[model samples]
Target: MAEVIKSLNLLESLKESIEKNNISDIKDAVEDMLISRINIALVGERGGEKAAFINSLRGLGVGNEGAALCPSSAAPDELAVFPNPKHPDFRLWDLPAIPSNTPFDPENYLERYKIIRYNSIIMTFTQNSSSNMVAVWREARSLQKDVYFALLASDKDTEKTLEAKKKASLEVLKAEGVSQPKVLLVCPTALEKLEFLMLLEVMLGDLPEIRAHALLLALPTFSSTLVAKKKEAFKALGWAAASLSAGVSAIPVPLVASMVDASIAVRILTKAQISLCLDDESVERLARQRGMDPTKLKGLRTCLLSVEISKSEVKRRLSVAEKDTSTATTKLVELAMPRHARSVSRSFTVMLQAINSAIDDMSADADKIIAVATGVSQ
Candidate 1:
C-alpha cells in the first residue's frame, strides 16, 4: 500500500508540472504551427461575385498590370490562391461555391475538398434571403472552427437596402450562435467603398494577438527624407559645437555649407505656404506690380541672411511689407515679398551660433528624455 501511494504521488507531481509548464509550451508550439501555415479560404455560390471580391482584397483588378490573382469566369467551381506580397508564409485560397441542388452532406463536402485544413473561412453573400447561404453557414460553423462572413452587396442599392440586408445577415449568424464574426462589406464597382476592403486585408494579414498588442504600444516611427534631414542637421550641430569647444581655428566650410543647404531644403519642403505661394515669378510679379524697381530691390539685398526664419517671422515680414506700401510697386512688392527667404537665412545663422553654445545643453536634454523613455529614442 505504501509503494502504491508513493507511485501515485510521483504521478500527481508529474501531472502538475505538465499542467503548469508543458501546457504553455504546447500552446506556443500550436500557435507557431498556425502562424507558419495558416490559410484564408473564400467560398461562395456560382456567379455570386466572389471572384471580384477576392481581387479587391488582393489589391488587383481584372485588366490591371499587376494582378494578384487571375480568376476564371467559366469554371464556376474552381479555386485560386492569391499571392501575398508581404507575407509568403501563408496562402489565400479562393474557392468556388457549391452548385445548387447538389449533395447537401456538409461533412462529405468539407472532407472531399479538404476545406478543414483552412485556418479561416470567408463566406460571401449577395442577398440575405439566400437559403443555400444559410445552409453553408450552418455547415461551416459545424465543421470549421474560425469563419468570417463578407457581404458583397450592390453599391448602386440605397443605404437603407444595404443596411436591411446586413442586419438580416447578422441576425441569421446570431441565430446560429455565431458570435462576433469578422464581417466585411464590398461594393466591387464603387471606388469610394474600397477602403473597407483594404482594411479587411490588413486585419487578415496581421496576427490577432499582434494587432491587439499594437493598439496599446506606440506606433512604429515613420522615417522619411524629412526625418533624415532633421537627424543630419542635429548631428551637424553637435559636430560644430564639438569643433568650437576644441578651439578649432577654421570650420570645414564645405561641411557647414552642405548642412546649411540641407537644412534650407528641408525647411522649404515643409513650409507649404512659402513653397507654393512665393516662386521666382511671383516675386518678380510683385516687384513689377508694386512698381518697385527690381534693380533697387537687388541693391537692398545685403547678406544672404544666415539661415531660414520662422513662420512667425515670415508673417511679420509680409505684414511689414504690406504696411510700407508708399508706392503701388512697393505694395505689390509687399504682396510678392520672399517671406521665407529672409527667415530661412536668419534661422541658418542662428542655428550655427546655437551649435556652439547650446550643444551640451541640447544633447543632455535629449539623453535625459531618451533615458526616461526606457531605451525608446526618436
Candidate 2:
C-alpha cells in the first residue's frame, strides 16, 4: 500500500511560489490558464481568401459551425455569443478591403476601424498585386507590425497560374525595395500541404515565451502535431495546480483537508477545458458544423471534460488514487520508501499523483474531440 508522504514544510515553499502566480518558469504551469493574448490582424484585398484562411488557420472550415465569418458574409449581431466569443483574447478581425481607386483613404479607413496597430499582420494577396494590397503592406510596415505575406490560391486556381501569380507578387515586393521578403504561396484551406503555417510559427518566434504559449493555445489545431503541443501545455499546468493544492492543504480549512483536493481539481480542469476548447459551448459549435448532436459526439470521450467533471468526482478520483497507491506501497515495504516525512509532503504526493493522472486523462479526452473535429476515428 502507498503510505501518506509527509512534508508540510516543502508544501509551504511550493505554495509560496504558486500564490505568487508568476509565469516565468515553463514548469510554473498553472498560470497558463489565465493567459492573455495579442492582436493578429488579417488585412488584404477581398479575393485574397482572408476569411477562409482565418478559418483554416483556426482549423475550421466553411461548414464548421464555430468558424468566424466576415461581416459582409454574415450578420455579426446574429451570431451566438451567449457565454463568450471563441479566442476572445486573440482577435482576428477581417478588415474591409480597399478598392484600387476609392474615395476612402488608407489612413482614414484605418482610423475609422480604430486599427491603430496590431501585434502581427497577415498580408494576403493573389496574382495581380494592386496598390491597394501594397497600401496595406506599407501601412503595416510604417506601423512596424509583424506582417506575413501569403499568396492565396484556392482549389480553382491551376498550378501554373499559382506559380505565375507567386512570381509576380514577389517581383512587386522587390520593386518596392522590400528585399527578399518572406512570401508564401498557399492554398489557404490546406495549411499542412505547404510551409506557410510553419513560417507563421517562425514569425511568432520573437514573442515572449508566455505570449507565444498563449498564441499557440489560441491557434487552431487541425493536426496531430498541434494536438500534441496543446497536450504538453496542459500537462505542464498540472504541476502548478498540484502545487496550489499543496498550499491549500497547508491552510486550516475548517478541519477538512479533502477540500483542497476538490477545489484544485475542479479549478484546474476548468482552466484546461476552456483552453483546450472542450467546454460545452465549443463542443456544441463543432458538432453543429459536423451535423452531429453535441452530447452524442461528446459521448465518445473516455474522460470527462471540465464542465462534465464534478467537484465530488474530483474528490472521489483523488481518494481512489491515494488508496490504491497506498495499498501498493504497503506491499513494497522491502524498499522502505520515505513517503511519510511531513504532513504537507504526504498530502502533496497524493495531490500531485491525482492531478497528473487527471491531466493525462484530460489530454486524451481532448485528443478524442480533436479526432472528431478532423474527421478521424477516436
Q: Please report, as a residue range, the 10-residue window in candidate 1 with the lowest summed lDDT.
A: 214-223
**Residue 248 C-alpha lDDT in model 2:** 53
Give me the candidate number with maximum TM-score.
Answer: 2
User: 271 in model 1: Cα distance from truth in Å?
Assistant: 31
Please, what are the lDDT tens digits per residue for candidate 2 over residues 153-254? 776788788888877877877876777776787677666556676765676575555566567677655556666666665544454455555445556657
Error of 1 at 77 (Å): 2.4
List candidate 1 segments past 4 Å from native.
Answer: 1-37, 46-48, 65-74, 129-131, 171-184, 188-378
Q: Write the per-residue lDDT of candidate 1 for residues 236-351, one digit (tens) a residue.
A: 32222222221111223445533433343234222211211122332233244335554433332221211233444433433343344234222322221134222222222333
Displacement of the residue 160 alpha carbon in candidate 2, Å:
4.5
lDDT of 2: 0.60
User: Against the true structure, what is each candidate's TM-score?
Assistant: 0.40, 0.69
After superposition, the stretches of candidate 2 with alpha carbons farther than 4 Å from their true spots are 1-32, 55-84, 98-117, 128-144, 158-160, 185-196, 252-261, 274-299, 320-349, 368-378
